[model samples]
Target: MDRERVVEWLEGGSVSIPKVLLKHYADIGLNEIEFLTLLHIHESIGSGNPFPTPIEISNRMSIDGTACSEVLRSLMKRGFLAIEQQDVSMMICEKYSLRPLWQKLASLMFETVHEEEEQERERSETDLYTMFEKEFGRPLSPFECETLSMWIDQDDHEPVIIKAALREAVMSGKLNFRYIDRILFEWKKNGVKTIEQARNQSRKFRQHQQPKQGVSSNEGTRKTTIPFFNWLEQ
Candidate 1:
Protein backbone atom coordinates (compact mmCIF):
# COMPACT_ATOMS: atom_id res chain seq x y z
CA MET A 1 0.00 0.00 0.00
CA ASP A 2 2.40 2.71 1.27
CA ARG A 3 6.18 2.94 1.27
CA GLU A 4 6.48 2.22 4.99
CA ARG A 5 4.34 -0.91 4.69
CA VAL A 6 6.41 -2.12 1.78
CA VAL A 7 9.70 -1.72 3.62
CA GLU A 8 8.32 -3.28 6.80
CA TRP A 9 7.26 -6.40 4.95
CA LEU A 10 10.67 -6.87 3.41
CA GLU A 11 12.37 -6.52 6.81
CA GLY A 12 10.09 -8.89 8.67
CA GLY A 13 12.01 -12.12 9.09
CA SER A 14 9.99 -15.11 7.91
CA VAL A 15 10.79 -18.78 7.54
CA SER A 16 8.06 -19.84 5.16
CA ILE A 17 7.90 -17.65 2.05
CA PRO A 18 5.32 -17.50 -0.71
CA LYS A 19 5.60 -20.09 -3.45
CA VAL A 20 6.31 -17.37 -6.02
CA LEU A 21 9.01 -15.72 -3.92
CA LEU A 22 10.29 -19.00 -2.51
CA LYS A 23 11.94 -19.58 -5.88
CA HIS A 24 14.32 -16.72 -5.14
CA TYR A 25 15.23 -17.56 -1.56
CA ALA A 26 15.08 -21.31 -1.94
CA ASP A 27 18.72 -21.59 -2.94
CA ILE A 28 20.53 -18.90 -0.92
CA GLY A 29 19.19 -17.08 2.12
CA LEU A 30 17.96 -13.50 1.59
CA ASN A 31 17.96 -10.67 4.11
CA GLU A 32 15.80 -7.56 4.48
CA ILE A 33 17.88 -5.45 2.13
CA GLU A 34 17.89 -8.06 -0.62
CA PHE A 35 14.16 -8.48 -0.32
CA LEU A 36 13.59 -4.71 -0.46
CA THR A 37 15.82 -4.41 -3.46
CA LEU A 38 13.55 -6.82 -5.32
CA LEU A 39 10.47 -4.87 -4.25
CA HIS A 40 12.09 -1.61 -5.36
CA ILE A 41 12.67 -3.08 -8.78
CA HIS A 42 9.08 -4.27 -8.96
CA GLU A 43 7.71 -0.85 -8.02
CA SER A 44 9.86 0.67 -10.73
CA ILE A 45 8.87 -1.89 -13.35
CA GLY A 46 6.32 -4.67 -13.13
CA SER A 47 7.67 -7.56 -15.20
CA GLY A 48 8.56 -5.15 -18.00
CA ASN A 49 12.24 -6.00 -18.29
CA PRO A 50 13.68 -9.26 -17.00
CA PHE A 51 16.79 -7.52 -15.79
CA PRO A 52 17.68 -3.97 -14.60
CA THR A 53 20.91 -2.25 -13.76
CA PRO A 54 21.82 -1.88 -10.10
CA ILE A 55 22.87 1.73 -10.57
CA GLU A 56 19.46 2.84 -11.87
CA ILE A 57 17.60 0.97 -9.13
CA SER A 58 19.91 2.39 -6.46
CA ASN A 59 19.39 5.90 -7.76
CA ARG A 60 15.62 5.44 -7.71
CA MET A 61 15.62 3.94 -4.21
CA SER A 62 18.06 6.66 -2.97
CA ILE A 63 20.29 4.03 -1.37
CA ASP A 64 24.07 3.98 -1.84
CA GLY A 65 24.99 2.83 -5.35
CA THR A 66 27.60 0.40 -3.97
CA ALA A 67 25.05 -1.10 -1.59
CA CYS A 68 22.60 -1.57 -4.46
CA SER A 69 25.27 -3.17 -6.59
CA GLU A 70 26.15 -5.62 -3.81
CA VAL A 71 22.49 -6.49 -3.31
CA LEU A 72 21.97 -6.96 -7.03
CA ARG A 73 24.89 -9.33 -7.20
CA SER A 74 23.51 -11.26 -4.24
CA LEU A 75 20.06 -11.41 -5.82
CA MET A 76 21.51 -12.72 -9.04
CA LYS A 77 23.47 -15.41 -7.23
CA ARG A 78 20.38 -16.40 -5.26
CA GLY A 79 18.19 -16.50 -8.39
CA PHE A 80 15.93 -13.71 -7.09
CA LEU A 81 16.88 -11.24 -9.81
CA ALA A 82 18.19 -11.42 -13.36
CA ILE A 83 20.38 -8.73 -14.95
CA GLU A 84 20.40 -7.44 -18.51
CA GLN A 85 21.91 -4.18 -19.73
CA GLN A 86 21.22 -2.49 -23.09
CA ASP A 87 22.66 0.63 -24.66
CA VAL A 88 20.24 2.73 -22.66
CA SER A 89 18.72 2.28 -19.19
CA MET A 90 18.95 -1.08 -17.45
CA MET A 91 15.62 -2.91 -17.05
CA ILE A 92 14.51 -5.07 -14.12
CA CYS A 93 11.75 -7.57 -13.39
CA GLU A 94 10.65 -8.96 -10.04
CA LYS A 95 10.87 -12.72 -10.31
CA TYR A 96 9.37 -13.35 -6.86
CA SER A 97 7.32 -11.76 -4.07
CA LEU A 98 8.39 -11.38 -0.44
CA ARG A 99 5.03 -10.17 0.90
CA PRO A 100 3.53 -13.58 1.57
CA LEU A 101 6.54 -14.62 3.63
CA TRP A 102 6.46 -11.30 5.42
CA GLN A 103 2.93 -12.00 6.56
CA LYS A 104 4.07 -15.21 8.16
CA LEU A 105 6.97 -13.57 10.00
CA ALA A 106 5.06 -10.46 11.07
CA SER A 107 1.62 -9.39 9.90
CA LEU A 108 2.50 -5.83 10.87
CA MET A 109 5.21 -5.87 8.24
CA PHE A 110 3.10 -7.62 5.59
CA GLU A 111 2.43 -5.55 2.48
CA THR A 112 0.59 -6.45 -0.67
CA VAL A 113 2.80 -6.53 -3.75
CA HIS A 114 0.36 -6.68 -6.65
CA GLU A 115 -2.39 -4.10 -6.84
CA GLU A 116 -5.67 -5.22 -8.42
CA GLU A 117 -5.46 -5.80 -12.16
CA GLU A 118 -7.24 -3.54 -14.67
CA GLN A 119 -10.73 -4.30 -15.95
CA GLU A 120 -9.32 -5.43 -19.28
CA ARG A 121 -7.70 -8.43 -17.60
CA GLU A 122 -11.03 -9.62 -16.24
CA ARG A 123 -12.71 -9.30 -19.65
CA SER A 124 -9.81 -11.02 -21.36
CA GLU A 125 -9.98 -13.96 -18.94
CA THR A 126 -13.69 -14.41 -19.70
CA ASP A 127 -13.03 -14.34 -23.43
CA LEU A 128 -10.20 -16.83 -23.04
CA TYR A 129 -12.52 -19.21 -21.16
CA THR A 130 -15.09 -19.07 -23.92
CA MET A 131 -12.46 -19.72 -26.56
CA PHE A 132 -11.03 -22.65 -24.58
CA GLU A 133 -14.44 -24.31 -24.30
CA LYS A 134 -15.13 -23.82 -27.98
CA GLU A 135 -11.82 -25.37 -28.86
CA PHE A 136 -12.40 -28.33 -26.53
CA GLY A 137 -15.93 -28.84 -27.97
CA ARG A 138 -17.32 -29.47 -24.50
CA PRO A 139 -18.44 -27.36 -21.62
CA LEU A 140 -16.04 -28.26 -18.83
CA SER A 141 -17.52 -29.18 -15.46
CA PRO A 142 -17.37 -26.55 -12.74
CA PHE A 143 -14.29 -28.09 -11.07
CA GLU A 144 -12.51 -28.61 -14.38
CA CYS A 145 -13.38 -25.11 -15.47
CA GLU A 146 -12.00 -23.66 -12.26
CA THR A 147 -8.75 -25.58 -12.65
CA LEU A 148 -8.36 -24.34 -16.19
CA SER A 149 -9.26 -20.81 -15.18
CA MET A 150 -6.68 -20.75 -12.40
CA TRP A 151 -4.05 -22.06 -14.80
CA ILE A 152 -4.97 -19.33 -17.23
CA ASP A 153 -5.32 -16.52 -14.69
CA GLN A 154 -2.01 -17.28 -13.02
CA ASP A 155 0.42 -16.04 -15.70
CA ASP A 156 2.54 -19.08 -14.81
CA HIS A 157 1.10 -21.13 -17.66
CA GLU A 158 0.51 -20.11 -21.25
CA PRO A 159 -2.58 -21.34 -23.12
CA VAL A 160 -0.29 -23.11 -25.54
CA ILE A 161 1.18 -25.18 -22.68
CA ILE A 162 -2.23 -26.44 -21.58
CA LYS A 163 -3.17 -27.24 -25.18
CA ALA A 164 0.11 -29.03 -25.69
CA ALA A 165 -0.37 -31.11 -22.55
CA LEU A 166 -3.86 -32.05 -23.68
CA ARG A 167 -2.56 -32.96 -27.12
CA GLU A 168 0.24 -35.09 -25.71
CA ALA A 169 -2.23 -36.96 -23.53
CA VAL A 170 -4.39 -37.70 -26.56
CA MET A 171 -1.58 -38.80 -28.87
CA SER A 172 0.06 -41.06 -26.29
CA GLY A 173 -3.09 -43.24 -26.20
CA LYS A 174 -3.63 -42.04 -22.68
CA LEU A 175 -6.57 -39.71 -23.04
CA ASN A 176 -7.78 -40.56 -19.57
CA PHE A 177 -7.60 -39.26 -16.04
CA ARG A 178 -4.21 -40.85 -15.45
CA TYR A 179 -2.79 -39.23 -18.58
CA ILE A 180 -4.05 -35.80 -17.64
CA ASP A 181 -2.62 -36.17 -14.19
CA ARG A 182 0.74 -37.17 -15.63
CA ILE A 183 0.73 -34.16 -17.93
CA LEU A 184 -0.06 -31.82 -15.07
CA PHE A 185 2.63 -33.43 -12.97
CA GLU A 186 5.23 -32.86 -15.66
CA TRP A 187 4.07 -29.29 -16.00
CA LYS A 188 4.47 -28.71 -12.31
CA LYS A 189 7.89 -30.36 -12.21
CA ASN A 190 9.41 -28.25 -14.99
CA GLY A 191 7.01 -25.27 -15.06
CA VAL A 192 6.63 -26.04 -18.72
CA LYS A 193 3.45 -27.55 -20.01
CA THR A 194 3.99 -25.71 -23.29
CA ILE A 195 4.21 -27.43 -26.66
CA GLU A 196 7.77 -26.27 -27.05
CA GLN A 197 8.87 -27.99 -23.87
CA ALA A 198 6.93 -31.07 -24.76
CA ARG A 199 8.53 -31.19 -28.21
CA ASN A 200 11.95 -30.63 -26.77
CA GLN A 201 11.40 -33.43 -24.27
CA SER A 202 10.26 -35.71 -27.04
CA ARG A 203 13.34 -34.91 -29.09
CA LYS A 204 15.57 -35.65 -26.11
CA PHE A 205 13.86 -38.99 -25.57
CA ARG A 206 14.40 -39.93 -29.19
CA GLN A 207 18.02 -38.92 -28.97
CA HIS A 208 18.44 -41.04 -25.87
CA GLN A 209 16.89 -44.04 -27.61
CA GLN A 210 19.12 -43.64 -30.67
CA PRO A 211 22.27 -43.64 -28.56
CA LYS A 212 21.25 -46.81 -26.76
CA GLN A 213 20.46 -48.51 -30.05
CA GLY A 214 23.74 -47.36 -31.53
CA VAL A 215 25.67 -48.71 -28.58
CA SER A 216 23.95 -52.08 -28.84
CA SER A 217 24.62 -52.27 -32.56
CA ASN A 218 28.26 -51.38 -32.06
CA GLU A 219 28.70 -54.15 -29.47
CA GLY A 220 27.06 -56.64 -31.82
CA THR A 221 29.32 -55.61 -34.69
CA ARG A 222 32.45 -55.82 -32.52
CA LYS A 223 31.53 -59.31 -31.35
CA THR A 224 31.12 -60.47 -34.95
CA THR A 225 34.25 -58.73 -36.19
CA ILE A 226 36.60 -60.71 -33.87
CA PRO A 227 36.58 -64.42 -33.20
CA PHE A 228 36.63 -65.81 -29.63
CA PHE A 229 39.52 -68.21 -30.48
CA ASN A 230 41.69 -65.30 -31.79
CA TRP A 231 41.19 -63.38 -28.57
CA LEU A 232 42.24 -66.44 -26.42
CA GLU A 233 45.42 -66.99 -28.48
CA GLN A 234 46.44 -63.34 -28.08
Candidate 2:
Protein backbone atom coordinates (compact mmCIF):
# COMPACT_ATOMS: atom_id res chain seq x y z
CA MET A 1 0.00 0.00 0.00
CA ASP A 2 1.07 3.56 -0.63
CA ARG A 3 2.22 5.40 2.52
CA GLU A 4 -0.62 7.91 2.35
CA ARG A 5 -3.20 5.17 1.90
CA VAL A 6 -1.73 3.22 4.81
CA VAL A 7 -1.83 6.29 7.01
CA GLU A 8 -5.45 6.96 6.10
CA TRP A 9 -6.42 3.35 6.85
CA LEU A 10 -4.64 3.40 10.20
CA GLU A 11 -6.19 6.75 11.17
CA GLY A 12 -9.74 5.72 10.28
CA GLY A 13 -12.34 5.36 12.99
CA SER A 14 -12.39 1.94 14.70
CA VAL A 15 -14.15 0.11 17.54
CA SER A 16 -12.48 -0.06 20.92
CA ILE A 17 -12.42 -3.35 22.78
CA PRO A 18 -11.23 -3.34 26.35
CA LYS A 19 -7.92 -5.16 26.87
CA VAL A 20 -9.46 -6.99 29.85
CA LEU A 21 -12.07 -8.56 27.58
CA LEU A 22 -9.50 -9.80 25.07
CA LYS A 23 -7.11 -11.12 27.72
CA HIS A 24 -9.61 -12.78 30.04
CA TYR A 25 -12.32 -13.94 27.63
CA ALA A 26 -11.23 -17.57 27.91
CA ASP A 27 -10.78 -17.28 31.66
CA ILE A 28 -14.38 -16.04 31.81
CA GLY A 29 -15.45 -19.28 30.06
CA LEU A 30 -16.29 -17.79 26.68
CA ASN A 31 -15.52 -19.67 23.47
CA GLU A 32 -14.39 -18.01 20.23
CA ILE A 33 -17.87 -17.55 18.74
CA GLU A 34 -19.26 -16.22 22.04
CA PHE A 35 -16.41 -13.71 22.33
CA LEU A 36 -16.89 -12.53 18.75
CA THR A 37 -20.62 -12.17 19.35
CA LEU A 38 -19.94 -9.95 22.36
CA LEU A 39 -17.55 -7.82 20.30
CA HIS A 40 -20.13 -7.46 17.53
CA ILE A 41 -22.79 -6.43 20.01
CA HIS A 42 -20.39 -3.87 21.53
CA GLU A 43 -19.63 -2.45 18.10
CA SER A 44 -23.32 -2.28 17.18
CA ILE A 45 -24.01 -0.37 20.38
CA GLY A 46 -21.21 2.09 19.60
CA SER A 47 -22.69 2.58 16.11
CA GLY A 48 -26.04 3.66 17.67
CA ASN A 49 -27.67 0.23 17.24
CA PRO A 50 -27.87 -1.07 20.78
CA PHE A 51 -29.19 -4.53 19.98
CA PRO A 52 -28.24 -6.11 16.64
CA THR A 53 -30.42 -8.99 15.52
CA PRO A 54 -28.94 -12.46 15.00
CA ILE A 55 -29.15 -12.00 11.20
CA GLU A 56 -27.27 -8.70 11.37
CA ILE A 57 -24.57 -10.23 13.61
CA SER A 58 -24.32 -13.32 11.41
CA ASN A 59 -23.95 -11.19 8.27
CA ARG A 60 -21.14 -9.23 9.86
CA MET A 61 -19.32 -12.34 11.18
CA SER A 62 -20.10 -14.54 8.15
CA ILE A 63 -21.74 -17.11 10.43
CA ASP A 64 -25.13 -18.76 9.96
CA GLY A 65 -28.06 -17.09 11.72
CA THR A 66 -28.83 -20.26 13.70
CA ALA A 67 -25.23 -20.48 14.98
CA CYS A 68 -25.20 -16.80 15.94
CA SER A 69 -28.47 -17.22 17.89
CA GLU A 70 -27.04 -20.23 19.72
CA VAL A 71 -23.90 -18.28 20.72
CA LEU A 72 -25.96 -15.32 21.96
CA ARG A 73 -28.21 -17.65 23.95
CA SER A 74 -25.16 -19.18 25.61
CA LEU A 75 -23.76 -15.76 26.47
CA MET A 76 -27.08 -14.63 27.98
CA LYS A 77 -27.33 -17.85 30.00
CA ARG A 78 -23.86 -17.20 31.41
CA GLY A 79 -24.89 -13.69 32.57
CA PHE A 80 -22.63 -11.88 30.12
CA LEU A 81 -25.42 -10.33 28.04
CA ALA A 82 -28.99 -9.14 28.47
CA ILE A 83 -31.72 -8.28 25.98
CA GLU A 84 -34.39 -5.74 26.89
CA GLN A 85 -37.05 -3.90 24.92
CA GLN A 86 -37.35 -0.10 24.78
CA ASP A 87 -40.14 1.99 23.29
CA VAL A 88 -38.80 4.00 20.37
CA SER A 89 -41.54 6.07 18.69
CA MET A 90 -44.16 3.69 20.16
CA MET A 91 -42.34 0.71 18.62
CA ILE A 92 -40.54 -1.78 20.88
CA CYS A 93 -36.82 -2.02 19.94
CA GLU A 94 -34.52 -4.52 21.61
CA LYS A 95 -31.62 -3.06 23.62
CA TYR A 96 -28.59 -5.00 24.69
CA SER A 97 -27.06 -4.55 28.15
CA LEU A 98 -23.43 -5.53 28.86
CA ARG A 99 -23.60 -4.42 32.50
CA PRO A 100 -22.80 -7.88 33.79
CA LEU A 101 -19.65 -8.07 31.67
CA TRP A 102 -18.56 -4.59 32.77
CA GLN A 103 -19.16 -5.36 36.46
CA LYS A 104 -17.05 -8.52 36.23
CA LEU A 105 -14.31 -6.60 34.40
CA ALA A 106 -14.30 -3.84 37.02
CA SER A 107 -13.87 -6.32 39.84
CA LEU A 108 -10.94 -7.91 38.05
CA MET A 109 -9.34 -4.49 37.44
CA PHE A 110 -9.61 -3.10 41.01
CA GLU A 111 -6.38 -4.66 42.26
CA THR A 112 -4.59 -3.82 39.03
CA VAL A 113 -5.60 -0.19 39.34
CA HIS A 114 -4.39 -0.05 42.94
CA GLU A 115 -1.05 -1.52 41.93
CA GLU A 116 -0.68 1.03 39.11
CA GLU A 117 -1.41 3.94 41.44
CA GLU A 118 1.25 2.65 43.86
CA GLN A 119 3.77 2.37 41.05
CA GLU A 120 3.01 5.94 39.92
CA ARG A 121 3.51 7.24 43.47
CA GLU A 122 6.84 5.43 43.80
CA ARG A 123 7.98 6.87 40.47
CA SER A 124 7.03 10.39 41.56
CA GLU A 125 8.99 9.99 44.83
CA THR A 126 12.01 8.72 42.91
CA ASP A 127 11.85 11.68 40.53
CA LEU A 128 11.63 14.07 43.47
CA TYR A 129 14.70 12.44 45.06
CA THR A 130 16.65 12.68 41.81
CA MET A 131 15.74 16.35 41.43
CA PHE A 132 16.98 17.10 44.97
CA GLU A 133 20.22 15.15 44.50
CA LYS A 134 21.01 16.93 41.24
CA GLU A 135 20.33 20.33 42.74
CA PHE A 136 22.27 19.66 45.95
CA GLY A 137 25.17 17.99 44.07
CA ARG A 138 25.33 14.96 46.41
CA PRO A 139 23.32 12.06 47.73
CA LEU A 140 20.83 12.97 50.42
CA SER A 141 21.51 11.95 54.03
CA PRO A 142 19.04 9.91 56.09
CA PHE A 143 18.04 13.02 58.05
CA GLU A 144 17.49 14.94 54.82
CA CYS A 145 15.32 12.13 53.48
CA GLU A 146 13.28 12.17 56.67
CA THR A 147 12.90 15.92 56.36
CA LEU A 148 11.70 15.53 52.77
CA SER A 149 9.24 12.87 53.86
CA MET A 150 7.95 15.09 56.65
CA TRP A 151 7.47 17.95 54.21
CA ILE A 152 5.50 15.67 51.89
CA ASP A 153 3.52 13.53 54.31
CA GLN A 154 3.11 15.64 57.44
CA ASP A 155 3.24 19.23 56.21
CA ASP A 156 1.37 18.53 52.96
CA HIS A 157 3.87 20.52 50.91
CA GLU A 158 3.61 19.59 47.27
CA PRO A 159 6.84 18.48 45.62
CA VAL A 160 6.49 21.12 42.91
CA ILE A 161 6.29 23.95 45.44
CA ILE A 162 9.20 22.51 47.41
CA LYS A 163 11.22 22.42 44.21
CA ALA A 164 10.25 26.02 43.51
CA ALA A 165 11.39 27.07 46.97
CA LEU A 166 14.68 25.24 46.41
CA ARG A 167 15.15 27.16 43.18
CA GLU A 168 14.39 30.43 44.95
CA ALA A 169 16.93 29.58 47.66
CA VAL A 170 19.53 28.72 45.03
CA MET A 171 18.99 32.05 43.28
CA SER A 172 19.54 33.74 46.66
CA GLY A 173 22.89 31.92 47.03
CA LYS A 174 21.66 29.71 49.95
CA LEU A 175 21.41 26.11 48.69
CA ASN A 176 20.96 24.29 52.01
CA PHE A 177 17.75 22.37 52.65
CA ARG A 178 17.38 24.27 55.92
CA TYR A 179 17.32 27.53 54.02
CA ILE A 180 14.75 26.02 51.63
CA ASP A 181 12.69 24.85 54.59
CA ARG A 182 12.71 28.36 56.06
CA ILE A 183 11.62 29.75 52.71
CA LEU A 184 8.75 27.25 52.62
CA PHE A 185 7.79 28.11 56.19
CA GLU A 186 7.69 31.80 55.42
CA TRP A 187 5.63 31.19 52.30
CA LYS A 188 3.14 29.03 54.18
CA LYS A 189 2.87 31.65 56.91
CA ASN A 190 2.04 34.22 54.24
CA GLY A 191 -0.43 31.87 52.46
CA VAL A 192 1.87 31.49 49.46
CA LYS A 193 1.10 27.93 48.33
CA THR A 194 1.90 27.97 44.61
CA ILE A 195 4.93 28.90 42.50
CA GLU A 196 3.08 31.90 41.10
CA GLN A 197 2.33 33.19 44.59
CA ALA A 198 5.96 32.74 45.63
CA ARG A 199 7.06 34.60 42.52
CA ASN A 200 4.63 37.44 43.12
CA GLN A 201 5.84 37.71 46.72
CA SER A 202 9.44 37.85 45.55
CA ARG A 203 8.64 40.50 42.96
CA LYS A 204 6.81 42.63 45.53
CA PHE A 205 9.77 42.32 47.92
CA ARG A 206 12.20 43.35 45.20
CA GLN A 207 10.11 46.30 44.08
CA HIS A 208 9.68 47.48 47.67
CA GLN A 209 13.46 47.59 48.25
CA GLN A 210 14.58 48.84 44.84
CA PRO A 211 17.27 51.42 45.60
CA LYS A 212 16.78 55.04 44.68
CA GLN A 213 19.43 56.69 42.51
CA GLY A 214 21.86 58.82 44.54
CA VAL A 215 24.70 61.21 43.65
CA SER A 216 28.22 60.13 44.65
CA SER A 217 29.97 62.35 47.20
CA ASN A 218 32.72 63.77 44.99
CA GLU A 219 31.80 63.69 41.30
CA GLY A 220 27.98 63.73 41.23
CA THR A 221 28.10 60.26 39.64
CA ARG A 222 24.84 58.29 39.77
CA LYS A 223 25.06 55.10 41.92
CA THR A 224 22.48 52.31 42.41
CA THR A 225 22.73 49.22 44.63
CA ILE A 226 20.07 46.43 44.56
CA PRO A 227 19.20 44.78 47.88
CA PHE A 228 18.64 41.00 48.06
CA PHE A 229 16.45 39.15 50.59
CA ASN A 230 15.90 42.28 52.68
CA TRP A 231 12.31 41.13 53.22
CA LEU A 232 13.58 38.00 54.95
CA GLU A 233 15.01 40.18 57.71
CA GLN A 234 11.52 41.49 58.39
C-alpha TM-scores of all predictions: 0.31, 0.58
List runs of model 1 lying over 4 Å from the truth: 1-136, 153-155, 176-178, 191-194, 206-234
Q: Give the Å shift of residue 128 in candidate 2.
A: 2.9
Give the clash count for model 1.
4
- The digit string of per-residue lDDT tens for model 2 on 1-234 reads 599999998886699998888998886677888888898899899989998889999998868999899888888888899888889999988899998888777776886789898898778778888988999899999999999998889988877788888788778787887788887787788898888998988787777775767889898889886655633565
Tell me, by TM-score, which candidate is best.
2
Alpha carbon lDDT of each predicted model: 0.56, 0.84
| Clashing pairs for predicted structure model 1, backbone only | 51-91, 52-91, 52-92, 161-194
Q: Local error of candidate 1 at 98, Å?
A: 34
